[model samples]
Target: MTTPLRSLFDFNGGVKPDYHKDASTRLSIGVLSAPTEVPTELVIPLHQSIGGTPRPIVAVGEQVKKGQRIGDADGDVSSAVHASTSGTVSAIEMRRMPHPSGLSSLCVVLETDGRDEWIACQAFDHKLATPQEIRDYLRDCGVVGLGGAVFPTHLKLNADRQGGIETLIINGAECEPYITCDDMLMRERANDIVRGVVLMREILGAKQVRIGIEDNKPEAIAAMQVAVGDCGDDLQVVVVPTRYPAGGAKQLIRVITGIEVPHGKRSIDYDVQCFNVATALAIYEAIGLGRPLISRIVTVAGNVDAPRNFDVLIGTPIKKIIAACSPLPDTNRLIMGGPMMGVEMPGDEVPVVKATNCILLGSNKIFPPPAPEMPCIRCGECALACPADLQPLELYWFSRAKIFGKAQEYHLFDCIECGCCSYVCPSNIPLVDYYRFAKSEIWAREKEKSLADEARDRFEFRQFRDVRDEQEKSARLAARAAAAAAAKQLATTDTVAIPNTEASTEANEKAALIAAAIARAREQQVTATPQNMQQLSAEQLAEISAIEARRAEIREQAKPHLPPDA
Candidate 1:
């Protein structure tokens, strides 16, 4: 191993709780016996990573081999899920998840066939493969942060903005009480962990590597040091102080490099990144052995006769391990992590997931309920104990009043929810609970606002479309009206433009000659008829009148029924 650094830095605040890991670390990692005769089923959830949830590819009643891919990664930021043991998929339905919320999630229930078989698997040469190929292989093999964050490992293998990773920190502190999975992994599989670390360093182009383990685990530190022997001058094992949350990625980075990464910023931005020891082992197994992550080391301690670490299969029931650990009669509750940061599981039958690191069984004596939450006295102890170095009292007040904006202004998101402030609060206040509540409310409001904004945008677009359509319709109608008017005007102009025809002139000349002839006839009758009819008496005149009336009727009947122009 390289020479250790002489100086170490300290994070602002942290609490040293009683590390109950001694009981679990007493024995080496034990393997759970496979179900050979008994009918046991494993309920594995597909949504196990920090980003997109995977989609199940295996159907119900399908036969799946151990380490066979059951769920495919959904998108760029997801991890695949594999079957833990050779089994036939009996049912694919919603099952109770191993979360504090007691919510149900989609799961594949595989009934073991007692044949722990495997599909084809071939190791790959990482040195020859491209960087993208290595990352894709790890993602498909279900490699993730096994330290409980469950962040997909492939996504974290990228280079920083500065172009390369400067320091790669491996977290072996296992600072949480009652959790010995990482410690046991480092002690037993230190060589594999180093191989994974070297692989990561090669991919990231890191200049140096630092494996930070708490001074409390002498065995792990010694094992890691020997495994890292002369790998390179840049790789070294540095023992950090035995402090609570020293295993925190940020805290460990600060302790090793004295670079305090701000909230909402990534460690990679500072050319440093961190991973868990178990995660490194999983990575090596994926690349070196071509074996996907189908199982993990889990610590079962607290209120149990045999508090031991077991290499348990994924999707194993919590009750199975509890039964093996011999849970005391007084064990009344099951928590899936250390007391300080673990969560109370919904029930004992809940299936294990990738995020589960430890199963801390609890009883009334082990973890009694906290004293009634008293009003904040502003004693300032919580601030001093906070590793994030934020004022806990002010945050509590803002959260209690439901002033989420104020809480955010106070940098509430920086709180890692490590529970140090709550542990040291003299007012017996559950400050972490308040912070979580505020955060949830804020998220809900943001989601609602987004939905409202989207709906409004859609509505506005519809209105604009309607107005445009109406204008188009009006323009079409006006065009038709103008076309009709133009046609009428064109007809009138054509009539005026036409020259006079010969037939029209003949009809006009005939009408004029008829009118002149009638006028001359009337003048001759008035002058010459009086001399011939001087001696004619009244009887002759009467007879003439009767003949004239009959002649007038005949002439009117004989005349043609036509207009003067025709």
Candidate 2:
């Protein structure tokens, strides 16, 4: 009898397209020699992952090592960056980065010295460490998902133990076309990948370990099977049918086991935590060898003379990688990452970031140019192909009208931008692009709102300060009045006899001086408008003159009674 379909819990409705993964997977992973002249100017984007941007730790002209911390994770939801090679920080300024917008971002440029050196890295005793300790160590080592998302790996592994994660799924499904980094990694470093999975199992207290590989990569499957044989029955190697996007965390979870991760729920919620094969290798390198993630396997393919997977250092320039690959004549489009999710580069000056997975140089003949976008024809193909089961047509309508709030109401944030909708769109509408635009617009508005809120806070704080100052002035005036009354009472009780006429004259003179000062202060406080002053009417000027004259008379009356010492 034939075995039942392994992926019973996989959600219905997914697109299956030709995945040309054989280009780079045919060759074993080759160790890339450090470029003789590593690009001095590195463009490190602030957003290299799914969480908060890291804060730069080094300034211009500061020297950094291969594994030295250059930027730190800002909060619980951030990832850190390490220097790819020993180099001096040349600059920290905004430059064009490898993003969908071709936008400028704050980047740290490093001038490498060619000598690949490392800084001090701490290693933990795995046997003696607690779950929290393991998580902390992974965080410090800059361990994150190597499957393009770049989520901090420690956070995923540190799920609630009460949930009881029984199985650890190692995703070896390199399903993206023309990208074979993960496949090559498993074939070349299968033992390390297994060790990483075992390490994860130890940390998560997982009972069983399952390695899932697509049947297209029989070599990788055979290699992994051989590697796990030494580890015994706790580890099993399973081959699933080749399918596009089969490597997605949720898809792989469903295919390997019959457990479905509910909507808006994590795979760990179903007692499963899926990790990419490359990520497992990185974890093994980090924990076993006490090394941070400084390098990764990158597939350099498409319209190139050499299509191979190389273990390239992070922060390597795109120009350098292209130069190494030696693209064929008539090369036009240069995209970073896989063909489906990769972003086109404006120029070759943009340096490689932590998320640079593949560099595809597409030529006219090999890779046909994308056709012009046509209006949606309401075919429902996008909905059928949607992995998340969202209505792409509805989203397209809302996004075009700039109705972001309504788009969000339809669960716009759930879109992973996997390009399945666009891939299957008969009209070639670029549905994913529209969704991305909508999301970006929403984020921009949110940022503006935050800034406005901050400004309002500052304004309120200033008003509060002014009110407090006024209250303080009133309190001081009250205290002075009370003190003056007490002094007058003491003077009346004292036995120092004086002429009442002289005392009255002295008091009158003091009152005249006080009245004159108060009149001057009131005059300074009055702001006369040009119109009002010009059209001053005879009555207004006469009133001012009368007040002046009365003040003069009062001064004259008290002049004789003024004390000689006053």
Lowest lDDT sum, 10 consecutive residues, model 1, at: 504-513
Counting clashing residue pairs in each candidate, in order, gives: 0, 0
Off by over 4 Å in 1: 33-39, 125-131, 159-162, 230-233, 473-566
lDDT per residue for candidate 2 within 423-539, as digits (tens), equals: 988887888889989999999999999999999999999999999999999998667655554455466556754345856645644554566569888887785444556777899
What TM-score would each prediction reach against the true structure?
Answer: 0.83, 0.80
Model 1, span 304-359: residue lDDT tens? 99999988889989898888888999888899988988989999999878999999
Clashing residue pairs found in predicted model 2:
none
TM-score of 2: 0.80
Which clashing pairs does model 1 show? none
What are the runs in model 2 whose C-alpha is more than 4 Å off? 1-7, 34-47, 59-63, 87-95, 120-122, 127-133, 159-164, 257-263, 461-465, 472-566
Question: What's the lDDT for all of these models?
Answer: 0.87, 0.79
RMSD of 1: 19.6
**Candidate 2: deviation at residue 506, Å?**
19
